[model samples]
Target chain A: MRDVAIVAFAQSNCQRDAGAQNEVELIMPVLTEVFKQTGIKSAQDVDFTCSGSCDYQQGAAFAFVAGVDALGAVPPIKESHVEMDAAWALYEAWLKIQMGSAESALLYGFGKSSPGELPIVLSQQLDPYYLAPLWVDTIAFAAMQARTMLDSGEITEADMAEVVARSRNNALKNPHAQLKGDQTVADLLKEATYVSPLRRHDCCPISDGACAMIICTIEKAEEWGKPYAIIKGIDHRIETHHIGSRDLSRSVSTEIAGKAAGVANGPVDVAELYAPFSHQEIILKKALGLGDDTVINPSGGVLAGNVMMASGLSRIGEVAMRIIRGEAKRGVAHATSGPCLQQNLITVLEAK
Target chain B: MAQLAAVVGVGQTKYKTKRKDVSIAGMVREAAVNALEDAGLTWNDIDAVIIGKAPDMFEGVIMPELYLTDALGCNGKPMLRVHTAGSVGGSTAIVAATYVQSGVFKRILTVSFEKQSESNAMWALSNPQPFSPHLNAGAGGYFAPIIREYMRRSNAPYDAGIKVAVKDRLHGAKNPLAHLQLPEITMKEVEDSPMLWEPLRFLEACPSSDGACAMVIANEELAAKSPRKPAWIRGAAMRSEPTMYAGREQVNPRAGIDCAKDVYAQAGIHNPRKDLDCAEVYVPFSWYEPMWLENLGFADEGKGWELTMSGATSLTEGGDIPWNPSGGVLCSNPIGASGMIRFAEAAQQVRGEAGDHQVDGAKTALGHAYGGGAQFYSMWVVSSEKA
Candidate 1:
């Protein structure tokens, strides 16, 4: 495969409502930042542009078309979109580069999760005939998974609370984080349950946000004279949709994707995990076989502030930023979609 | 470096106003199974799955591919979902082809569909947003002004739209799977149709359809092992521009023109009219037949209607350069699937498997789709011979 690198990244601050600011307003700032960082102007600078977003996030048909306003795609520019997280958009852009279709690409993801009932809105992603009609919230689905692990002696409520505590503590250093507080596991465990066996603190905060990034060939990285992170490997895998068909406590798909992404090829100095629920962080850590050596979620991860479509790409961006800042030499990023993490994507990034 | 890719299999469900016999998953599976069978492969042999649909409101299933991965055999495999407005179908195919063209996967399954009957598409489409109030004008109402402007600029006869309506419906009649089979349609019948949008008769607009289309794309080595002939992919391109900008041309969008130019350039075509044996352009409205003709370089600016006046686009008289021989969107428009149908039909013609809708001796063809008020454009060129 052709060598591709992450040259620039930017994101909006996580907000509860972002009132009056539509999708375009939420996106333009990040786009402007990435453009400035890369010393490029508009979509014309890149050979391709791809976005990751969902219509359900906005509750309108063809809602994603409105996002094009942020790009000012005049005189027309090559572009595509995925009804997925921006990490998948990066995957597509990576393939475009490898295929020699283009030398550079701009990728973005955005969502306003505050507009609707976040968990209930996600119920529509379930099997329509079997599960969605019943209106089971996604939080309940994750709760069941957490309970499964709890009953199996895999983890305790304190362990889950500790993960949340670590995430919030890590957010102290992350200025973009929406929720950040220094708290002990005992303090987190004192909170009441929002869903059975799961405290409200264990779940990610619903926030409105958008993120943008630009990637280019390795040669372009040097020509631009900017620090970059090489994407050493990336892969994604999915499990059966039937929630009852597999054990919710284990992430077979994440393990398979982790293997495919070649995460073990080198020492992982830092890892950005997209575990919206506290328990999922432990599950992914086990699935990827990461020991205490890998420092997880230096940016507090999505658990501190979840931006839906943007969070996955944020994981990638967060890790790449660490590499660019000379904080870590190598890292891993993960993104998930569907109830209880039915779909998972893993990417391995390395500093030059 | 990019590797070669080819379309070795194509499949579709019968175009209908409503597919009540099966659920959404079943509907997509029908097309997938048929495609796999056509390619002489099974679900286990596929390496990845890429699906596309216009919007979740059409079926009320947000990211339907999540629920669909099982039926597609995507377990422990990469599954990507694409959404690019109405052009998503074509864009999805482009993304799927890249998995192979990039030498990442040997075989991939790509599918696009729209179950418009599951929910009210018109209401879903006009859902008011924070910045814009509900106009309540459906797609036709939105495009009527553009159609009128095209007529004024080109000086097209009042009967130009009527002729295209009758011509495509007749082509639809030849295909058994078409939703509206009007083999004996006439100009008088079209003229009497209700005028929903001024100068646009009810018959001139495409019908809402419930259908799905699927294709199996493979790398050079896997495609060479296929039982049937493969449609060699020459070029694929996509373009987008901002909507409602000042001094922008809505009738003949720059995005469409640029997209066509990019694809034609990759295919080594200096003149589209002669290089392409046929075309399956997206024409939801009859007037687009002429508008796109000029935009796609098939005709000169302001002179595209002459080709229509001379019956040059008709399969019977157009000889080698027929457009929408399979009746097209007007005959069966499952919105999202419509674009892939155009793409699959292009592949079918080159593979000599289009049945009755086949353009005689078609060796090269173009598949085109545009979406989001004509700001998003995706097109591809395919030939019987390798690029």
Candidate 2:
């Protein structure tokens, strides 16, 4: 495989409601930041460009097409888009580089989840004939999964609270994080359940934001003289979509993808996981076989602020940033789609 | 150099206004199973699945791939969902081909579909948004002015679009799966049809369709071992520009020209009209035929209508360079699947498996698709021989 590395990454400050800002407005700032970081004037500098976004977040069809305006895609450029998270867009760009179709790529993901009923909008992702018509929102599905873990003695209410408390504490240092505080596990446990077993703190806050990243062949990174994080391995796997068909207490897809991504190839200094719920962080940590040796979610992860499509790519950027900043030598970044962790992607990054 | 890949198998569902006999999952599976069967393989042979469609609103199903994992045999494998407006089908196929060309996976199953019957596409496409003009009235309403501009610039005959509608419908008659099979269609019928958009008549527009298209792309090693001949992928290119921008040329988009040039260059073709055996281009409205003919270099600007008037783009007319032998988007437009149908039909031509709509002794062909006010373009060149 051709060597590829993430040399630049930028993201908007996660906002609970980016009032009146359209999709293009939410995306332009991050695109400008990434361009500034990489010294590239516009998307025209990259060999290829790809994006990830969902239209439901904006309550409009073909909403992502507007994102092109943020890139100033004049004279045309090789570009593609995915309905999934931007991490998958990154994967597509990586494949392009691997195929020698491009030496460098620009990718981004954005969402205006605050414009609509975020959880209810996510219900449309379920089985259209069965689950979607019933309108079982995303929180209900995650709540059921958390209840399964509680009933199976796999986790306790305190365990979930502890995860939330850590996320709140870690997020205090992340300026872009929307939710942050020094709340303790005891304080979080006192909060009433928002959906039976899942408390408000246990769930990730719906956020409106965008993130952009620039990756290139190792040679290109050297030519730019930028600090970079080498992408050693990346792979994704999906489980059966039926909620009853799989074990909710365990993230089988995450385990499979983590293994395939070579997560255990060496010591992981840190890991950034896109676990929207507090209990999911525990499920993912166990699934990836990370011990106390690996610091998890130093940037507070999505539980601090979840920007739908952008959250997944932000997880990857968080890990790569740590490696590039010399805060960590190696790390694992995970991105998940579908309810109950039905699909999972693991990307391993290491410092040069 | 990147590893080579080829289209070893192709399958498409019978186009219709509504496929009531099957669910969305069933419709996609039918095409996938057909493609797998054509490749003489099974579900286990595919390493990954890449699916594409226009928008979640078109079917009221958000990210349908999540619910379709089992139907596509994508469980425990990588599944990528591509959405690039109307050009997504072709983009999805290209993404699948890259899985092999990148040497990450050997066999990839790529599918694009639209079950427009589940919801109203016209309403979904024209949903009002803040600060945006509400003047948009579906795709035809947007393209009619562009077509009018082409006619004004070229001074082409008023009947140029009518002829194209007649010719493509005739071609659609030969393909059993096409949604519209108007074997007896005439220019008079098209010209007399209700004018939906100024120059574009009701008959000149493509029907809203419910269907799916699938293809199995494989690495050179696996493609060579396939039971049937493979259409070697000589080149694939995709280009995109902002939908509305100052000084943007909507009549003949620069993205279309650049994409065609890039793919042709990769295929080692200097003159598209002579180097290509045939083309299956996206033509939802009849007037786009001549407009794209110029954009794709089949004819020079202001002269594309001349080629159309001469029957150079008609298969039954014994034209040297026929376009859309299997009818194309004009006959069967499932929005998302429309682009891949062009791509798959191009492969069928080179593979000598197009049956009744087969181009004679076709060894090289071009598949083209454009979307979003013609600002997005995807094109690929395929040949019988490997480079």
Candidate 3:
């Protein structure tokens, strides 16, 4: 396979509501930032462009079509879109490069989650015949998983509280985080339960945001003279969609994808995981076999600020940025979709 | 160099106004199972699954792939969902091909579907945005002006669209799975149909359909061992421009032109009309047939209508280069699946499996689909023999 690297990454600050700012407006700033970092004029410079987003975020069909307006795609460009997280968009772009179809690619993901009842909107992702008709929201599903873990002695409420405490403290250094603060584990544990055994702080905030990344062949990275992180391996796996079919406390797909992505090939210095619920971070850590040496969620992860379609890509961006800045030598980034992480992707990045 | 890929199996659910007998998962499974049966493989033999659809709102399901994992047998495997508007079907097929072409997976199952009976597509497409004008009601309302511009620039005969409608419907009659089997449809009948949009009559527009299309793509190694002949993928390309921009050519969009040029060049076709044996271009409206013919290099600008008038694009009429021999979007438009149906039909022609709609001795064919105000385009060329 041709050597590929993430050369630049940029994202908008997570907001409770990006009022009146449409998808194009939410995306343009990040696009400009990535271009500035790469010293490129527009998407015209890239061999391919792809994006990931959902129409339900805007309450309309084909909502992603508006995002092209931000790219200045006037001369016509090779492009595609996925109704998925941008991390998968990166995967598609990587495949294009692997097939010798493109030398470089520009990819982005965006979402306005504050417009709708985020959890209810996400419930539609469940099995239509069995679960979606009941409108079992996302938080309710996560709570059930948390309950399962607690009852099985896999984790304690204090452990979940500690994850939330650390996430909040870590987000203090992340300017783009939507939820951040210096809070003690005891303080978090004191919060009233929003759902049985789960507090409001345990769930990620609904935020509107966009993120962009530029990837290219290692040769192009050197030619551009930008500090970059090589993508060593990337793979994704999906589990059965039936919520009752699998163990709710463990992420089987994550383990499969992590193994496939070669996460254990090297020592992980930093790990950024898309764990919308605080307990999921613990679940992913165990699945990936990360040790105490790994600095997990240095950017507070999605628990601090989840941007829906963009958050998955952000996990990857966080790890790549750490490597580019010489703060970490190797890292693992993970993204998830579906209730209780039915689908999971693992990307391993290393510094040059 | 990229690995070679081929379509070893193709399957599609019967196009219809509503598939009342099956649920969404059952409907999609039918196509996937048919494809697997054609490939002489089971669900476990596939390496990955990639699905595509126009929008989540169309079925009131957000990212339906999450729920479809079991139906497609994607458990413990990589699955990707693509959504590129109307071109999603063709784009999804290309993505599946890339998995094999990139040497990432040996065999991939790709599916595209739309169950329009579950929700109102017209309403889903016509949602009012905050700043965008709500003047256009549905797709027809939006494309009527573009069609009018094409008519004025080409100065084509008014009967040109009527001729295409009758021709494609007649072709549809030969395909048992097609939604509209208008065996006796005539130009005179089309002319008398009610006009929904100017220059577009009821019969000239595509019907709303519920359907799914699927294909099993494999590497050259696996394809060679297949029980049936394979359609070798010659080339694939996609292009996109902003939906609207200053001085954009809506009648003959640059995206479609560039996409065709790139794919033809990859397929080593210097002249599309002479090289490609047949084509299955997306023509949701009849007038788009001639407009795309010119854009796709089948004919010179302003002369595509002459080819239509000469019956050069008709299969039953013994045309040298037939278009949509298995009917087309105008006969069975399941929105998202429409594009892949075009692509699969093209492959069928090359594989000599198109049954009654077969273009005689077709060795090479082209499949094309466009979406999002004609700004997004996906096209591929397939040949019976490997290059």
Candidate 4:
């Protein structure tokens, strides 16, 4: 594969309510910032542009078409869209570069989950015939997974609380984080469960925001004169849609994707895992087999602010930023979709 | 150098106003299974799966590919969903081919579909946005003005669109899978149709359809093993421009022009009219047939109508070039799947498997799709010969 690198990254502040702002407004600032950071004058400066977003987030067909208005695509730019997290969008961009179709690409993702009841909205993502009619929200699925782990003696409620505790502590350093505090595991465990074993704090916030990143062939990054992180490997895998067919406590897809991504080839100095729920982080970490030396979610991960489609790409950006800032040398970023992590993407980034 | 990719198999579910017998998942699997069977491969042969559809609202299912994991044999495999307006079907196919072209996956399953039966497409498409104008113009209302502008600019004959509607329906008569099969359609019949959007009669506008298209794309090595003749992808390109920007020509979008130019450049074609055997251009509206002929450089500006009038785009043996031999989007449009049908039809023509609608001895063909207020465009050139 060609040497693809992340040259720049920018994001909007995670907010509970964007307050009358539409998707285009949520996306424009970050797109403008990434272009400015890369020193590229406009959207035309990039060889390609791709975005990741969900139409269901706004309850409209072809809703993502509006997001393109922010790109100022007057002269027409090579572009595509993914109904997925921006992390997958990044993967598509990487593929374009590897195929020699493009040298530089700008990718972004956005979502506004506050307008509707998020869990109810997410219920629509389930299988229309079997699960959606039940209104089986995302949290309910996570709760089932957590309960399975608890019943199987695989993890404790306190363990899930610790994940939240650490996330809160780490999010304190992230300016864009929506929820951050210095809470301890003991305090979190004391809180009542909102759904059986899963507590209110165990869930990621319903944030409305967008994120943008610019990547290029290493040669193009050099010409752009910017610090960058090499994307050493990336892969994604999905599990069966039938929940009954999957092992709820284990992330088989993440493990397969992680191994394919070469997550074990080198020491991971930092990692950003997109586990929207607390217990899924434990599931992902064990699947990835990360060591204690790796700093997990220094940018607080999605629990600080779950920007829906943007959260996964944000995880990748967080790891890339740490590597670029000399805070780490190598890292693995992860993103998940569907109920109970039916699909997962793993990306490895390293300082050149 | 990028690895060459080829389409070893192509399949489509019957294009109809609604396939009420099957569920959405069942309908998609029909196409995928047909494609795999055509490739003479099983589910285990595919390395990855990529699916595309316009929007979740159309089916009332967000990211329906997730629900279709098992249906497409994507479990424990890499899967991605693409959405790029009406161009999504073409873009999805391109993404699947890229995986093969990048040497990441040797064989991939790509599918695109729309189940208009699940909901009202026009109502779903007309949903109001927060900041956008509330003109309440659905897709046809939005495009009619653009079609009018094309006529004004080119000073084309008023009968040009009616001719397209009749011609494509006649082609549809040859394909059993097509939604509209008016074997004896005539100019009078089309002209007698009600004018829904001024110059565009109801017959001139594409019918809403429920269908799916699937293709199996493989690298050269894997394609060589296939029993079927492969349609080698010579070049693929996609372009997008902002909506409502000043200087943006809605009629002849620059994105469409640039996309065609890029793909043609890669394919080493200087004259689309001469080099391409036929084209499966996306023409949800009849006028788009001529409009895109100019935009794709098949004819000079203002002369696309002349090409149509001269019968250059007829499917019969007398025509120099053919367009939409598979009846195309105007005859059977399932929105998301319409673009892939165009791509798949082109591949089929080059592979000499287009049956009755086949352009005789077709060696090279073009597949094109555009979307979103004419701002998004995707095109590909495929040939019987290797890239």
Docking quality (DockQ) for each candidate: 0.87, 0.90, 0.88, 0.85
Evaluated against the true structure, the overall lDDT of model 2 is 0.93
lDDT score for residue B92 of model 2:
89
Name the lDDT value of residue B152 in candidate 4.
Answer: 94
The docking category that best describes candidate 4 is high
Clashing pairs in 4: none
Quote the positional error of residue B381 for candidate 2 in Å.
0.5
DockQ score, prediction 1:
0.87
What are the TM values for chain B, all candidates?
0.99, 0.99, 0.99, 0.99
Q: lDDT values of the candidates?
A: 0.91, 0.93, 0.93, 0.91
Q: Spell out the clash pairs found in candidate 3.
A: none
Q: If both were scored by lDDT, which would come out higher, candidate 2 or candidate 4?
A: 2
Judging by DockQ, tell me the better candidate of 2 and 4: 2
lDDT (C-alpha) at residue A67 in model 2: 90
Predicted chain A of candidate 2: TM-score:
0.99
Residue ranges of candidate 4 with Cα displaced over 4 Å: none
Ranking of all candidate structures by their DockQ, best first = 2, 3, 1, 4
- Candidate 4 lDDT, tens digit per residue, A1-352? 6678998999999999998898889999999899888998878889888899987777666778888888877778888999999999999999989988889999999999877898998898888998899999999999999999999999998899889999999989999999999999999988888988899999998999999999999999898889999999999999999998888989999999999999999999999999999999999999999988888898888888999999999999989988899999999999999999999999999999
For candidate 3, the lDDT comes to 0.93
B1-387: candidate 1 lDDT, tens digit per residue: 689999999989999999999899999999999899999999988889999988888899999999998888888899999999888889989999999999989999999999999988777777787687676887888899999999999888999999889989988998888999898888999999999999899999999999999999999998899999999999999999987799999998999998998999999989988999899999999999999999999999988888877888888565557899999999999988889999999999999999988898999999999888888888989999996
Candidate 3's C-alpha runs over 4 A off are none
